[model samples]
Target chain A: MSTGVKHFIAFAALAIILIALPKVFVSGSAHTMMSLMGIMIIFALSYNILLGQTGLLSFGHAVYYGLAGFCVAHAMNYIAREKIGVPLPFIPLIGAFAGLFFGALFGLISTRRAGTVFSMISLGIGELVASSALILRSFFGGEEGIPTNRTKFPPFFGYKFGPQIEVYYLIAFWCFVCIALMYALTRTPFGRMCNAVRDNPERAEFVGYSTQRVRFIAFVFSAIFAGVAGALATINFELMNSQSLGAGQSGLVLLMTYVGGVGHFIGPIIGGVIITFLQISLSDITKAWMLYFGLMFILVVMFSPGGVAGWLALHQPLLKGGRIFRLIPAYALALVPMAMLAAGLIMTIELAHRMLVDAQSDGSVMKLAGWTVDAAKAQPWMLAIGLLVCGALGLKLAWPKVREAFAAQSAEVAQ
Target chain B: MTPALSLQDVRKNFGPTEIIRGLTLDVMPRERHAIIGPNGAGKSTTFHLISGRIKPSSGSIRLNGAEITGMAPYEINRRGLSRSFQVTNIFPRLSVFENVRCGVLWSLGYRYSFWRFVDKLRDANEKAHAIVEEIGLGARRHAPAGILTYAEQRALEIGVTIAGGADVVMLDEPTAGMSKAETEQAVALIRKISEGRTLVMVEHDMSVVFGLADRISVLVYGQIIASDTPQAIRQNKAVREAYLGEEAH
Candidate 1:
């Protein structure tokens, strides 16, 4: 299929999945989860606008996302208190405008020097705002944060979204619209010039497009989308605070997007969903979840530099025909060790945490496999050995088949 | 006859160091002109002045009687002038076809095209294909420009300059590193390519200069010592002493 057609089909599939999610799951937790995915999708894709399309790395993108969330919350409170009166849905637009204003303000200065300088300026801005989130309590609501309600809107679909499912549709709709606009922007003439500027600024200048102008336009557009995400998040959660605009949030967005893939529009989408899932699931299972997350990010950066989109693109042909079934054995062999190692590591971490934090009497602690051991005397060597043995066996069994699959895929595409 | 391009009392200096000192030359329309000099002789600098890559320190540059000394490169390009660089400046990541298409698009009055899709523009595509074929790169039209051989890259550069359809075309060392057959092919390409236009070049190869340029200018230490028809240049004592003296052996 043509590239455009393929992209359209992929977009359609995504929309269908998002629309049917609440019904298929029929759970409040699933709705909240989907809403979180919607918010991250915006953040990651906006970040991709600078990093992937313009060849710029920004370290303070969370400032816009976080600030926009704060702006939306303020707007929501104003509406609720009759300081301003309108539907809650229109408030995200206010968030987008806030994002655009700040993005342009920062972009004007930051885009003056592209590579490392831009990254540094963004980092500085992120730190500055995160620290000030406490000072601006009147507007930012201090540490407690300000709360607003989606129920403020007149009931449109016979539901006020007091439930998370109603909010999921709203967030999902906005996410789809923003992603589509961002995608369309990439295909525009200005978008092509963004690529040109990314590749060679001098050449783009000679061709009569100012490099700064292109970069500035892209920067502002990215910020607006990020802000929209912040606004959507506020409506879903019914509160906003400094943490919404914090540097950590910015770093998380970057990690998710890069892990998903930058250049591909769909990459950010996949990344947002997966990272959100892991953030919630992993944290519950272990205190060292963040450490594992960092290691996983680094591994992805090193091994699959192109991220998940690139990895999936590489596997596209193999997944198309009778050869699809051939992947099962490889997948199974890969999954066995991966599952074992993950479970073992989580078990080890949780058991350690329980022993230390909730110590048992008689100086003995309960273990994962129904055994009790002296908490102070428990050795980590056995857990390490088990994880390593399983991991090594998994790698050994997976490599040859994985290599064969890649080689076959390469050969098939070359023709 | 009126000159197509003229540089009168052109002197380019950076801070205190003088580069092109009081240089004056004239090329009539349709003349194949060559400037030859040793390194730091300001031959490339003179091209930079004419192409508007750099403004002249003193004096004026005129193309068909209108002064155009300090105009921007694109403005100079728009006003019936175009040039290739000493180093190949083609966009490496783009396909050979896309590179030429960009050249054709700007020349065909479609620059900064936001509304027109590059692939859907038939006229630009056809013209780009024609130029690619002209430059002997039709077979590799889809290949990235960076992956092409050095000789092919130079040929592609020439194609880009001419693709603009400018009145005066300047090529800097068009066949600098090509083999014997490739240089011969380059000379033929230059001759065929510069048919109706006023062609200006800076060449080190005496053989190529003798075979191609109708008028030759010899420069020594940033000053043109001889400007004459090829026959006169070949016989001038100062020209021979300044340039051909070392090559006589």
Candidate 2:
């Protein structure tokens, strides 16, 4: 099929999924989760504009996200109080404008230089905003943060956004629009020059491009999108807090972008979904879920520096050559040892935590895999260690077969 | 005829050390001038000074009778001056076509244009394609510049240098790491691209210098010892002892 047709079909499929998702899930929590995911997808993509596309290593992107969120929240509150008759869904535009305003302000100073200096400036700004958010209680609302009622706004088309599902559709619409626009920006000459500046600033200058201008433009655009995401957050949660502007929030977006693979356009989307899923689902099961996230990020960096998208992209040639199915047996063979390794590692970690920290309160016995095991006992320790060693050995033994199979398939495809 | 580029009393200091000391030279319009020098003679430094990569301590540099001493590199580039680095400085990750297209973007008046898709710009694509074919990398146009062979990368470097359609082109050791056959090919390519354009080159290869240069300047210890035809430079006693002494063997 032609590429244009493929793109049309892909977009059509995406629209269908977006429209049908809340219907299929049909729960308030599901709507909430999907809305959060949509907001995160926008946030991640915006971060990618600087990190992935422009090669600017910003440590304080959440400044834009948080600042915009706060601005939108305040606007919403004012609108409701005055009965200004603005529709609920159009509030993100206010966030976009606020983001653009601050982006232009900060971007002018930060984009004067690229690399370490720019990163340092962004960090300083982020810290300044986050700290100021507390002292300026009227604007940031102190520890409580500013709250707004989305349903208070006059209904548009006779539909009040009181229901979570309504909010989901609103967020989803903005999400699709933002994604399409960001993707289009990447295809433009300015976007190409951003990559050039990122690769080699000297070469870019010789080619008649002002590296700082390219960076500043990209930074502003990124901030605008991030602000939109922040606005979505305000509408969804009805509150905008100082936590949104913190370094931790910035780091979370960075984690998502890196894990998704900044090299490809769709990488951040994958990262957003996976990281959001992990954040939501994993947090419910364990309080140490963040540790898992750090571990996943490290693994991605070491094994697949291009992130998940990059890892998947490696199979493109095989797929094109009609040889992707050839690696299935090898992948299946590797899965058993991989699962064993994960189980053994998790067991060791949980048991060790129980033995070291929780031992003072809860004596000896730890519940794992529905089995009660004595944490202080030598027998259980030996069992855990044996499983760990066995899993490691099994993986070591199985890896060569997977490698050999891959090599064979590659060689065949080459022929 | 007016000089295309003129440097008067050009001197560059890096902290305590002076690199280009009291260097003055001029090249007439459309002249292919070669600057030959020994190691550390500041040949590349001179290029940097002209291209605005580094500022000279005290000097007046002019291009087409316009002062450009303290201008930024892009500003100098905008005033019809383009250069390539001694090291292969093509964007390593971008495709060869994209690399050349980047060079042509500013000259084509597409400065910071985020509204137009670059692929749809027929003039830019055609110009970039012409450059790729001229550099003899037509088959490898789609390859990432990093993956090209050293000689091919050198060709790409030249392609990028001339892609802007600048009237004055400065190439720093464009054939630095090439084999003899590759150097011949590069010299031919350089000769083709530098037609009706002012070419300022810093080269070590005597054959390329004597073969392609309309006039040759011999630089030694940050000073031009001789500025004359290749024949006169070859005959000058100061040029012989200062630079061409080893090459004479």
Candidate 3:
């Protein structure tokens, strides 16, 4: 099939999936989860316009997301208090304009240089704004932040958006639009120039482009989309707090974009969904989830620098030739030991947390992956250590054979 | 006719060190000019100066008698002068067609536009394809530029430099690091592209310089010691003593 047809079909399938998700899941939490996915996807994709598209490494992207959230929150409040005619669905545009204003305001100085200097400026701006969010009590709402009611707006098509489903659809609609536009951007002359400037700014200039201007426009666009995301987020939670624009928020988007992979268009989407899911659900599963997230980020950077998308893209040749199945045995062999190692590590961490952190309150007894373990007991500790050693040995033994299988398939593909 | 490029007493100084000292040069339209000099004679620096990669410490540089001293590189490029680097500078991850298309975009009035799809720009795409074929990289059009052979990349570089339809093209060591066979092919490409266009080059290879340059200038210690025809440069007493004497040995 032609790529255009393929893309259309893929996009249609995604739309269908978005429409079907809430219906199939049939839960308020599921709706909330889906809404978060839409917001995170927009935020991550916007971040990629810098990290992936333009080769900008920004540490302060969350500033746009957060500031835009505040803009939306305040706009919602004014509309509600003044009894204005605006509806809730269009609120994200306020965020978009705020993002654009801030993007233009900040992009001027930051885009003057690329590399370490640009990154430092972003970091500085992030700190500056994040601090301002606290000190500027009137607009930022001080420590409590700004909160607004979505139901306060006039009904659109008789949909007051009091229901989670309605909110999901709104976020999903904006999500689809932002995602499509961002992807379409990659096909434009400006997008090509962004790539050009990213790859070699000097060459870009000689080809009749102001590389600084290209980066500045990209930064503005990125921020606009980020603002849209923040607006959607405000709609989601009915509030915009300092944490919304915090370093943690910015760091989360970076984590999502990187782990999802920064090389491909869909990388950020995958990152947003997966990381959002983990961020929401993993806490319920383990208190040590942040540590796990950190571990995963480190591994992704070191081994799969292209993120999950890169790993998937790397295996396309094998998948096309149906050689993937041949390597499955090698992979399966590694998976067993890898799981054991993961389990052992989890048990050890949980045990340590119980003994060190919660022993005074929750006691030394805990349930881990269906096993009752006492942190005070030596048998469990010995078992955890044994599993660790055995898993390590098994993985070490299995690694070369897996490499051999990969090499063999790669060679065949090359031939 | 006014010279296509005129650098009158151009001088560049880095901190306290003066480079491109009192460099006055002029190239009439459509003339093939080569600047040859020993190492550290500021050959590349001169290219950088005229191309707006760096500003000269003092002097006036004009293209087609229009003063362009200290103008931004993009502005200078828009005024119909384009250049290539001594190093292989290109958008490495982009496809070869995309690389040439980037060169063609601004000149074709598609500057900084995010609205229009590149594939939909018939003028840009066709021009890019034609240039790719002209450079004999038709088969490699879809290949990422980073993966091309060095000779192929140099060919692509020259293609990009001239793709903007610039009437004046400056090349810095375009044939640097090429094997004999590759250099011959590059010379052929250079010759074809420089036809009816002003060509300025900085080259270390004597054979390539002697073969391609209509006129040669010897730059030593940031100053041109001789500016004349190639044969005269080959025989000049002072030129030999100051520069080529060491090479002749």
Candidate 4:
């Protein structure tokens, strides 16, 4: 299918799901998921305005997101405390302009040089803003942070949004509007110049578009979207903190987008869902889930720099060339033992951490999957068997098919 | 005839070292003028100065008697003067058709189009299609320009320069790496495109120079050694000394 068609279908499906979410999922769960998706989608797409289309990687995008979020939080407080009567929908506009203002300020300096210099300046700015957030307590909420009540907003369609589900609809609506606008922006001449500047700045200059201007515009646009995401996040959480815009959360965005696929527009959406899901579900299952996630991210960076989207794109040639069914059986066959081994490893690591951290009081043990496992004990034999079987099966199933795919790719190249 | 392109006492210096030292030249209307020189003779720098890629340290350049020495490259292109680089400067990532479409966009006054889709810009698209046809790249229009053969890239470069519909067109080393057959074809294309427009090309191919140029100027050490008709340039003692040898003169 054409990429546009695929995107349309996916977007339509997502829209329908969002509209029906309150009916399906529990209100709390739906609200949380909607907020996460909304925030990440905006951030990811804004990041792509620089990274994907402009071919410029940014290390400090979180600064814009966090700053904008903080700004919106302050504005919301103003509205709540009877200091101002700033309307609810217009709050994001404040955030957007705040983002644009800071973006232009930073872009003027950062757009002068790209790559490492750009990243460093952005990093410096991120650290400065984050540290300042702590020092400036009165305007910012300081260590305690600021919280808001959404009931302050006037209701619409008989939905005052006192419930979480009502807020989810608001977030979903904003995400849809922002995504459509950003997507439409890409088809503009200004957006075309962004892509042109990425490929060849000299050519763009010769073609009469100032390369620096293009980069600056893209930077500002990305910043505005980041701000939009931040604003939505503030409304959803009803709380704003310094950590929301710090380096750690910013780094999480990089992990999400790249892990999902940076180039594909939908890649970040997939990434947001996966990471958010893991953050919720795995945090309950194991203490060392983040460690495992970190390892997976490192492996993904090293092995599939194109991200999951690139891997998906590879399936296109395979499917079109009639090698799909032939390759999948081996691929699935390789996965059976790998899953078992992963579960074993997780158990073993969690047990070891539990023993080392809190061994004195915990005397209970649980046995499952042929091993008598204590929560605070390590079974070396079980770990060793799991690793061996997993490794051997993985290598057995993966090597030949990978080789065949490469051979096919090279053959196509040769022709 | 009044000159179509003129450079007057144009001087360019990089900090302390002057690359172009008090050079003056002019191209007569509809004339095929060739500029030739040894390496580091400031030949390419002269083109850059005229194209506004670099500002002259001093002096004025006039296209059709309007001063344009210090204008930006795009502004110069808009003022009916276009130039191709010595090294092929093209959008490598764009397909051939899109590259040509970008070339046509500026001329069609669609500089910042947020409303018109590129496909819907019919006049510009048609012009680009026509340029692709003229450059004999109709078949390869869908291919990414970076993947083109060296000769094909040269052709695309010419197509791009001429696509803007400038009155005076300058091509630097237009046939640098072509075989004999390719050179002949390039010479023919150059002749075809230069009709009713002033052409100033810096060429290393003597056969192409003799076949196409109506006049020639030889430069040695940032100075014009000789400027004369092609036949006179072929026979001049100083031109031979700058090029072939004393014995040839």
Candidate 5:
């Protein structure tokens, strides 16, 4: 197929999936979670424009995400109070405005110095805005945040947005547009310049570009998309607050992008989906879920370092060459012991949590990955350590077998 | 011709030390000029001043009769002057074709544009591909530039330098670390690109310099001791004693 046709098919497939997902997973919780996933996907992708595309490490991207969200929240309130006939869907425009204004405003200072300096400036700005969010009650609504009613605005085409389904579609529409636009940007001349600045800023200047100008433009574009994502968040939760602009939120997007793989366009998409799922679902399964999240992040950074998508990218050429079956032996040798290692690690963490964190409040007895185990006893601890040792030993021995399987394919792997 | 590039009384100092002390030179339009000097004689520093990499402590540097003193590098480049570094400088992660294309983008009036796709710009793609083919890297158009062989990367650096259609080009030690064959190939490429434009280069390779330069300027201790044709410079006593040493004898 022609590339145009292929792109059409891909985007259409994405749209169909987004629409059909609600049909298959028919639950109120699923809709809530899916809506959240859409917002985060945009946020994380925008963060990549700075971190991945422009070689900028921003510790304060949530500044734009939260600032735009507040603008959107307050705009919603204004529209309702004035009965301005503006529908809820268009409120993101205000967020977009806020992003453009503030992105340019703050970008001048932040993009003046790249590398570690840019990161430090961004951190300072994030703190400044977040602190202001608490003290400026009239504007930020203090800690409770500015809560607005989505139904208060006029309906669009007879849909009141009162039901969760209508709100979900609204978010899905914005999500689709933001993603399409962001993807389009990566192919433009400006996008190439961003990459140029990232690869060699000094060379970029000699080629008739101001490195600062390229970085500043990239920062603004990133902020615009981030603003769109923030506006979507306001609609999803019906409340925008100080926590929206917190350091924790900024760190979450960073985790998503890094874990997704900064090298690929869809890396953050994979990051957004996986991280959002874990953020929501992991809490119910274990009290030490945060520990698991930290462990997974640390492992991704150290071993794979490419994030989940980058790991999958390694298998792409093999699949294309019809040699995927050759990997089965290696994969099995790796996965079997890796699973044992994960189980042992989790068991140990859970036992310690019961002793130090949960013993006084909850209990000494708890379920581990759906199995009944008493943290108070010695039997589980001994089993945990035994499995951990054996798992470590088996994985160590599996390395050569893993290397042997891919050794023949090394020619195709070097970029 | 008002000289394609004119540097009059340019000087640079860092703290207590003076690098380019009261330097002056003129490269005429379409004339190939080469600057030769010892290691710390401030040859690269002169290129830096002309290309706007650094401000002259005091001097008027002009390109095409227009004063470019204190202008930003991009502004100077926009006015049709370009340079290649002493070291191989390229966007390592970008494809070889993309690196060349980036050099041509601003000159082609697509400065900082985002609305249109780069692939769809037929004029730019054709120019970039032709230049890549000219540099003998057409086969590696899709390869990332970082992985190219050293000689190939040097050729690419030259391609990027000339791709902007600049009227005046400066190159610092373009053949600094090349084998005999590579140096000959680079000389031929440099000759082809400098046709119908002004070429200024700093070189340590004697054969390449005498072969390419219409006029050679010898710099010693941050000052030009000799500016003349190849034969005139070779026979000058001051030039031989200061830089040429026994090579000229």
Candidate 6:
């Protein structure tokens, strides 16, 4: 197939998946989750524009997202009170413009120096806005935050967006458009220059390109997209607050981008969906969900610095040469030990937490996995230690087979 | 005829230590000039000052009779003067072809264009491919520049320097780490690319300097000891005592 046709097919597949998502899940909560995922995907990609493509490390990207959200929320309220004729779907454009305004404003100062200085400046700006949001009651509404009704806007084609499903479709539309534009930007001469600037600013200057200008442009675009994500979020939750612009929000997007892999275009999207899913599902079942997230991030940083996308990309040569089947048995053999290790570790942590922290209310007994185990007894501790030791031994014995199989398959592919 | 580059009493001081002290030289248009010196004699420092990577503590530097003193490197480059580094400074993550294409971008009037796809720019692509072939890295054009052999990286550096179509091209130690055959190939490549363009080079290799330079300047202790034709430079007493010595023979 030609490149054009292939791209068309891929786009069609993506559209189908996005449009069919809410229908397949078919619940109010599912619609809410999908909408959140769409917003996060856009946010992560915008963050990637700086971190991955441009090699900038920003600690306060949520400033744009939250600022844009607040701006759109104010616009929505003003439109409703004065009966402004602007429709609801076009509100993100307001956010985009606001984002661009602040982006250019902040970028002018921060982009003068890159690397550590740039990161520190962004952190300072983020904190400035976040703290100011508390005192600026008229705009930020203090602790209560500003809330607006999306349905107050004039109807678009007789649709007031009264349902969550309609809002999901709106976010999905913006998400796809922003993703397509960001991807197209990467193919342009400007995008190539951004890469050149990122890799070596000194050489980039000798090549007759201003490194600061390239970074400023990328920073602005990244902020604009992040603002769009914030706009969609404002419409979904019907509120904009200080938490939206906080450090925790910035950290969440960074976690998604790095864990997904910063090297590839699709990495942020994968990260956005996975992190959002885990955040929603895991938070319901366990109070230690954040601990799991931190562990996952550390593992990704240590073993797979490229993140999940990088790990998936590593298998491409094997798949191309049809040598993937040769390593299947080794992978399957390794899976059991890995599962055992994870279970043993989780069990130990939960049991220890129960014993030390919850000791007063629960007596010495802990209810876990439909079994009542006495924390004072030695049997459970011995069982946990036994599981941990056996899992480690199994992993030690099985790891070499996986490595040898992988090396042999790689050699075969190389030949 | 106007000189391609002119530096007059150009002195650069880092803190209190003067690196280029009152160094004055003139490079004629379309001539290959070489600056040769011992280690720590500030040959690379001179290149940095001329290229606008660093400013002179005091003095005037001009290109094509236009004052470019204290200008940014990109502004100097926009005025049609380009230089390669002594250390290999090509973008390591970019492919060899991409590295050359980056050099041609500003010259082709594609400054900061975010709308048009680069692959669709036929002229840029053609020029970049021609440069890759000229540098003898056509087969390895798709490989990342970081993984290229040392000689190949040096060749890519020269290719990048000349790709911008600058009127004045400066190279720092183009054959610093090459073997005899590799140095011969590099000299040929440099000579071919510098045709109709004024070339300035800092070289440690005597053979390369003697074979390629039209005129030679001997720099020692941050000052030019002698500036003359290659044969005259080979016979100058001060040049012999300061730099050439037995190597000139």
Candidates 1 and 6, the one with greater DockQ? 6
Which runs of model 4 end up more than 4 angstroms from their true locations? Answer: A1-11, A21-27, A83-90, A286-294, A320-323, A333-397, A405-415, B1-4, B12-18, B55-59, B63-75, B78-80, B246-249
Second chain alone, TM-score for each candidate:
0.97, 0.98, 0.98, 0.95, 0.98, 0.98
Interface RMSD of each: 3.0, 0.5, 0.7, 1.9, 0.5, 0.5
Give the better candidate number (4 or 6) by TM-score: 6
In candidate 3, what are the lDDT values of residues B1-249, reduced to their tens digit? 999999999999999999889998988899999999899999999999999999988989999999999999999999999999988898999999999999999999999888888888999999999999999999999999999998999988998899899999999998899999889989999999999999999999999999999999999999889999999999999899988898878
Per-residue C-alpha lDDT of model 5 across residues B1-49, encoded as one tens digit per residue: 6989998999999987999889999999999999998889999989988
Which whole-number lDDT from 0 to 100 does residue B87 have in model 5?
Answer: 92
List ranges where model 6 is wrong by over 4 Å: A355-364, A374-378, B246-249
lDDT of every predicted structure (CA atoms): 0.82, 0.92, 0.93, 0.79, 0.91, 0.93
True contacts kept of each: 0.19, 0.84, 0.92, 0.45, 0.94, 0.88
Instruction: Say what the interface RMSD of candidate 3 is.
Output: 0.7
Looking at candidate 3 chain A, the ten consecutive residues that score lowest on lDDT are A365-374
* DockQ per model, Cα: 0.31, 0.90, 0.90, 0.46, 0.92, 0.91
Give per-residue CA lDDT, model 4, range B1-249, as digits (tens). 668988888888998898888888988999999998878999999988888889998988999988887887777887888888878988787788877777777778877665656666789889999989998999999999899999999999888788878879999999998899998888889999999999999998888888889999887766777888988987888778777473345
How high is the lDDT of residue B131 in model 3? 98
| Candidate 3 lDDT by residue in tens digits, A46-138 | 999999999999999999999999988988989999999998899999999999999999999899999999999999999999998889999
Candidate 3 ranges beyond 4 A from true positions: none
| Real A-B contacts recovered, model 6 | 0.88
In model 1, the runs with Cα more than 4 Å from the true position are A1-8, A83-85, A156-159, A317-379, A389-401, A412-415, B1-35, B40-87, B102-139, B149-170, B184-210, B214-229, B246-249
TM-score of chain A of each: 0.89, 0.96, 0.97, 0.87, 0.96, 0.95
lDDT of 3 at B125: 93
The TM-scores of all predictions, comma-separated, are: 0.83, 0.97, 0.98, 0.87, 0.97, 0.97
| Candidate 5 lDDT for residue A344 | 88
Compare the candidates by DockQ and give the number of the best one. 5
Q: Lowest lDDT 10-mer window, candidate 6 chain A?
A: A345-354
Question: How much native contact recovery, as a fraction, does model 1 achieve?
Answer: 0.19
Could you tell me how far off, in angstroms, the CA of residue B107 lies in candidate 4 after the best superposition? 3.3
